[model samples]
Target chain A: MTLSLPNLGLGIGWRAQLAHAILNRPDIGFVEILAEDYFLSETIPPPLQALHDRGVHIIPHGVGLNLGGAEPIDPARLAALGELAQRMQAPFVSEHIAFVRAAGLETGHLLPIPRTHAMLDILVKNIRQAEAALPVPLVLENIAILFDWPNAEMDEAAFLNAICERTDALLLLDLENIYANARNLGGDPVALLDRLPLERVAYVHVAGGYEADGVFHDTHAHPLHEEVVALVEALYARMAVPGVMLERDDRFPDDAELGTELDAIAAAIARGNIERHERGFAHPVLSDAS
Target chain B: MMSASREAISDTQADLVRALVHGTPVPAGFDEQRVQAVARSLVNKRRQALARIWPSLVKRVGDSFIAKFTEYGQTHPLPTSANALADGRAFLAWLAVKEPPTDDLRIEALAYDLRWRETPLGLCRRGGFGIKIARLAQSEKWLLGLRTPWRGDRWWGMPANV
Candidate 1:
């Protein structure tokens, strides 16, 4: 899909396992890294430096901001993030619109925040704080949460749209999360897509998820599911999403397997080549048509 | 009726930071019920996502390990202040200068923990538990730190009296 970012194309999550392979063969799309990993040290990891030397556009994704909670953004974290961004010369940096802490302590996992007006205000403020701290525009990703907050006052799409609008932040739309949310909560994934402000989305994340009993878990172990692929294809029709990266947190496939998945995502993006104005048909194979 | 600044959290929100600096438990003030409730929720979410890969972490390290680390991380953003990071670096330094006994299983386990368990990220990798300690200690980042340590990597101090 065409995107605002330069040379926006398919990419993979910057992982440690495939570092050698990636550096050796630099034909793959851009790489997205978790911001915290590179910040603690002044010197970049040799492999990352090698990738950078090879002209790889690295984007940083953060996990510990705890942005959508009652707590305020920590300046040290922001400064470190800003430092990492500057050092890496990252195209952009992003974090989840969820809280990792409550009552002034880390909860470890990215916890869902109540999608209320107050929560929205807090998230937007945190984004602004982060944006002000860094030289780049901050993007907010919608997380894959298993439960809804009891106090949620608005729907996820509206909350996301409103946050993006208010903070002037870009959206890192994770298609797997939307699919997982739809399966878990019984919502129309496409409708949720239609509800979001697609124009603001700057990047897309496609990851594999697992199913326990009937519940879909946003575990990145498995291969990219067909449904998430279709959702991404559908969204690309309206938005010029720049970077589409594959996120696998477990059971990292060999370069061959990862290559296949990346190829599939790239092919799907080409096949659906639905322009901005066209209402495209989903590939029957990937569509959830019973 | 709160101002935006009311939401500000000093590095204190990170649990590991509080515990390391203040000697607090992972979740310092919660009663048993509240602690149990949060723990249960965390375990439930982690059971499938993380447990499937590291089947024994919950039992061996307990579910609160990450929460504890993240908390400490909040306060100890720099490597010097983080005891855990310091200790982790020390293990590497020890591995570099000394030879671990090959015969002892307990030493082997310590070696195992040293290689994989020190950092939550490394431990989470698939089959990451089996990596050798010497190699792990000598990873590019850790090695870089030993020579010219960064804020997150461990430090090796020169003797005060040269």
Candidate 2:
């Protein structure tokens, strides 16, 4: 159910360090920007706009909507986000299905929610609310939760399927988060994906995370490990996911380092037997800039 | 009679998690339960604060700062403040001057916030002003990312371009 996308093969999260390098080399498939970064009416992040102009398919990934929270979705925030999406012409926007705020309490982190029918009802309503406010499809990612409720009503797969089924939105399957949760929580990644409605996946996110006490935290700072790359290959082999974005949040490396990772991601895709790289974008990179 | 397969968590531990989560009172009998509770609460509080604030804050600062705040909140969970704002300021200040954070739980909590929130910069600026913590401080040879305040107590370092 992915909306009409521009066919971004391998994208990178927009970063200041890699901006010049990317603009100079414009060979990567696309660029995914944190939507809020470019939302300001008075001022905009120049690099993001440049990427959008450069024919980079600007995919938006959000941080703080807290879609899975018990609280009602904040309409004001959604309005601003919608305006940003319209302005950017983003194909898809994503957020995690975890709560950042509680009942009268704002923790400011993506807290795990109890996977009950009661919670699923809350999630469906929230996603619909977000979808109504924005023209773009609201893609939800599976968070790498550290804790599980003692009274979970459904497995992770069933919970997500119910949400997407109701909302009619797409899934931004983050392979790294899935792999991380499989290791941390007691779940099998392959089986979980098998149960999920893979036809709804709009795209895939692959990132590097740090390991601690044998648990991998989705830090997005380190290089993507071989295992995650393999998992990504496996997922692509099963589904025709149109795009992939590699995210890095901290300890940002030089341009060459990022380029290498982008290359590696593309290589992994080819090895996975994802064909049809020949059809290039009709618009030239420079002609698309505002 | 041996203990049950899983012993009941002591009240003290539950209280610690509560205090950590809700900013409730913690009477000082520190036991293992208290420790676990405190850790859980700290993680939750840190995430909440980050979730609530990261969107606006990241816009003002950089992505690097998301990690910085997360590190501070998790490591300094038994914060010297009553709520999220004060706790965030104190944690940021602590992070600027303290040695690098090493705790895995703390780092995990930090990563969660970075992934979860798009903290507005305006809130971060208010927080910085409230705590009198400056994002940048000047030293002789280098510009330190010190968490010291600009016009508040414990002022150090020369003015910019000195």
The Cα error of candidate 1 at residue A26, in Å, is 4.0
Could you give candidate 1's per-residue lDDT for residues A209-286 as a string of tens digits? 888766677878798998888877777655546667889877778878887888888876765554433543432222
TM-score of each: 0.68, 0.67
Q: What is the lDDT of residue A183 in candidate 1?
A: 84
**Where does candidate 2 stray beyond 4 Å?**
A1-3, A39-43, A274-290, B1-162
Considering every candidate listed, which one attains the maximal TM-score? 1
Candidate 2 residue-wise lDDT, A249-285, digit = tens: 6667787887788788877777654422222233112
Clash count for candidate 2 is 29
The ten-residue window of minimal lDDT in model 2 chain A covers A281-290
Q: Model 1 chain B, poorest ten-residue lDDT window?
A: B140-149
Candidate 2 chain B lowest-lDDT run of ten: B1-10
lDDT by residue (tens digit), candidate 2, B56-162: 43333345665666566554543321234445545544753665433322323333333222244212121132222222322322222223245432223344565
